[model samples]
Target: MNTWQQAALAAEIENQAQVPVLSLAASASVRPSRRLGRPTLIQMGSNIYEQVRCISAIVRSYHWRGVIAIYEDDAYGGNAEMLTLFSEALQRVGSEIEYHLSLPPISSLSDPRESVYQELLKLLSTQSRVFIVLQSSLPMATHLFQEARRMDFMGKDSAWIITDSISSFLDSMDTSVIPYMEGALGIKSYYSKSNRPFLEFSAQFQKNFKSENPEENNTQPGIHALRADDSIAVIARALERLASDDTNTPKMMLKNILARNFSGLSGNIIFEGGDLSNSNSLLFRIINVVRTGYKELDFWTQDLDNPFRREGRDKNSSRNTTKVLDGPVIWPGYLIKRVPKGWEMPTDAKPLKIGIPAKTSFDKFVKVDEAEAEADKRYSGFCIDIFREVLKILEQNYSLPYEFHPVIGTYDELVDFVYNKVITPISSL
Candidate 1:
């Protein structure tokens, strides 16, 4: 049942039985195919496309040029489609996915902690410090962050952003896991909790939940539960509308459901193309994980021309020009008021080897002095002076350790050496 194929089969069977199907699967892969004509299955979850757009905007606001993707490898094809959509969104924001790490689905993994540790080790060799997590289960996510903290991957120079799949269920996780996920950012579907109807339902839900399960400590309902309630409300309204029609067919029921547009427990319930429409009412909130729980930082909505700004703040606020969130964030390791650079060189990284041609027709432009000790070889010329000056300027901001080596080869051969990784790079001098 975790796979999209199985879900599709179940929907098809229900369709044959003349029953209207409303799926809670939030992934794009589970969406009904349009080529077959009218959709027999309707999704009642939030749109995955909107989630991707919100994440992309956050990355752009922070000016992150590259990021690493971590996602579940499942037979459902949901995470795979999510990854593709994220990659495309990042490109539109002048960013690219440097690498993608795939973890086995939680259902398939016997030792999730060890598996996550192995994957985290692979990321240590990479330079990208910004990571985007998509379509991860609670168990897998818990282990992943625990391993990340143990390996020092949760540092001042690291930034982690998780989509709603895991974020929506953070309340259900044990308190011990929240510490491991400190400094992580999450995009969660937004709903108004202050409304009278939601408040009443929450109180009733807590009362029934405690009575049903005495052992459970966290009795509050998560986004999934709220959406489930909204889904039921939608069905009830659709059935009532169907009662007016003489023919109460499954198709007619579906039509009535799609026509619904009203505020519910999870937000406005509106359908477009057999899925929740990405309208103004459909909004996502950004959160930063802290010691107690997580703090709401900002909201992303289709209604705003500039979605990065905080709610009720001026759209032209100067802070909005640079910072995405209004509140200060505590980075990993309890570092206060420090923003991660989102990249770092490995501790064991070697000095860059710069190759220089030993023989050149134009000595003024490029010249190399041979020495018995290869390390003692001297490179000097107009080009060498310019390269040295450029390095000096770069060293002010970065630690660029490099060494020059004289190479005995034609210009073409020297270029080939650099291309084949024989040398880190080559300069004319």
Candidate 2:
């Protein structure tokens, strides 16, 4: 039932039966052609595009230039659209997806642990340490992170950012799996807990939930549960409005439901184009996973134009101009305060070899003095000085390991050496 195919089939069956479908979990963007000029399915959940915008803002805030995308592979084209959305979102923030690692649904694999371990091994070969997980279920995400931690992928230089798919259900996950995913960041739909209706509902829900499922430890309802309550509220309101009219056709009910707008448990319940509109009231909470659970770092709202502003912060304050998170984050592994660079060099990577001409007419531009001891050879010139200074500046921010090698060849030979991969690109005077 997690796949789009199953959801589509369910929707089709409901449409044929002339029943209105209110989905609380599915957020796939259905094509207009499939709707046939009228929509049968009304998604009460938050929009995926809005989630993408929040994630883009986080990437910008961290200054990560590239990230690897890890997502569940779906055969029914649902994940394809997700990848396209993520790619476009990252591009808008001056970042791009460096690699896409598709994991099969955990149910499809015979040995999920081995499968995840093999996948993590493939990622170790790449330089991108920043990972964005999309469309992953709780079980799959837990196993993936467990394998990642086992393989040392959750080190200080690494970062993991998860979308709402897994974040929404973090409360229900087993506490044993949390250690593997500590220091990860996630975004989930926000709701007002202080509201009277929600507070009363939460109290009643806990009592009923514990009574029905005694073995379950966490009785707190998640975002989907809140949305389900709101969905029912929406239908009840629509039915009340239609009580005056004798004719309550499916189309009429749909119209009435779409026309009604009010504040509900999951924020402003407003529908446009058969889905929840991206309104200012709809907010996403940014969370950082700690040893004891996750902490709310900040909130992202459309009203602020995608910045991660703190709750109750002044709207007109000039100090909040930058799109930065308000609190410090416990980054991956041992680095609690230091931010990850989002990438790292491979352990076996060789130092960059810069080839310089052995003989030059203008010693001022390029000169190489060969000593009796080959190891004592001296290299000096305006270009070498400039290169040394540039390396010094770069080393201040990056660990750029490089060495100079004098090549006994003409200018043409040096160019050929670069073209043939024999030497790295050389800067000319």
Candidate 3:
């Protein structure tokens, strides 16, 4: 069997019609894995959906209605599938993408036209304040954030969200990149730090690895090592099961291995068909970049509505049991004690054109007085009164130069208008 770092190796193995293969890394795309059959090929590690919830939750927290995605363009195992899943996750959280920018692989970074720095310049000029960066390279991310810093795009009103790929890499990242990443947030895989099994396994691995590599400076085990450990354990278990049944082919052994659930250094291990147990089953840690380094800000789970939870966490505690972030966050530009608004009015800003549904049946709920000919139509109703109070609340933080516009349409149209951004919903006044 041949081994390689590239995720495309799994697909390549199938093209050769070789023996059954297994991927310790999650980067293996499910599409190709399924084509090879569940028993023939299996991928171990968290899927995209598990990681995206954390990112979507951050956008939802700021009440950002739109976001721009900047992802790496790689055919083997890249951001295309991740972007699709992430966009869906955002939609589920009542947010939509404003734009998607693709950056070529790091190998192509030397080319000026494909440089991420050039792309960052374009992103700087855009109106979307929230960005989801799904690049797999830490060096590219460093360059990206450095350019953003130079462009003054890292501000209190703007947000930069990263995925686990970059998050895990930050642990050993260069200190030079830290300053550029200030006020940035990241969504990374969360392994229970308090889990005794994991802690013990990590310590043992570190000691053994140090002994194995005497000259190596850093002996810290990464996600790959954990995956490798799980893979070895899986193979050993399969070997034991193989001793009992001579008729069980390699495919059958692979099937038995996929069905087996156990605990490992990474945490609980299980496979659902060729994928992990649950696409949304993974947990993520939310972090913010600071002058010193990154700090733990919150936690995110599958519950999209209440995804972020505060620290002082218990590993065994459920997501529903956790709270929001503990204290004030230090935003970009060294600003302390404020959350980014995630948006701003355009230069050609206009009054918030509020869409009020016109109704004949429930006239008291929303009566559009067409008799009063005015630039902004007159509206009086119990519903209008409720909306007015919400406007007052909004005015405290933002300018509420709003004008009521009556829409002679069905309830569906009113919703569609809001969804299409034709008019702001008065319900969100």
Q: How high is each candidate's TM-score?
A: 0.84, 0.82, 0.71
**Candidate 2 residues 218-305, lDDT tens each?**
6777888888888888899889988877887887787788888998877888887777766655378889988777888888877435
Stretches of candidate 1 off by over 4 Å are 1-6, 15-18, 29-38, 211-218, 303-305, 314-322, 350-379, 382-400, 403-429
Tell me how many clashing residue pairs each candidate has: 0, 0, 1
Candidate 3, residues 1-429, lDDT tens digits: the string is 111135445546554443456665444243446654434666665555566666676666567888988866664545666677878878877898888887776776566334766777676445677878865567667777777777777877877888776776665455556778888787667766667876887789778877887665455556666767888888788778878987667666776687777877666777765655543344777787787667886777665445555566564454432233544667776666666766644433555567778665877888888687774347888888888899789778777677666666678878787667664444444
Give Cα-based local distance difference scores for all models: 0.75, 0.76, 0.67
> Compared to the true structure, candidate 2 yields what TM-score?
0.82
In candidate 3, how many Å is residue 10 off? Answer: 2.4
Record all residue pairs in model 2 with backbone atoms less than 3 Å apart, i.e. clashing: none
Stronger candidate by lDDT (1 vs 2): 2
Please state the error at residue 168 of candidate 2 in Å.
0.9
- Candidate 1 lDDT by residue in tens digits, 1-429: 433445556777776655666666565542443433337666666667778888888888888888999987776555667777888888888888888999987788788888888888888666678988876778888899988889988888889998888888776556667888999999888887789988899899889988987776666777888988988889999989999999888878878988988988887777777777655543888899887678888877664346664666664542342455666877776766767888875233656667778788898877887653564336778988888899899888878777777677788988787645564334433
Best by lDDT: 2
- Which candidate do you rate higher for TM-score, 1 or 3? 1
Model 1, residue 143: displacement in angstroms? 1.0
Model 1 residue 208 CA deviation in Å? 3.2
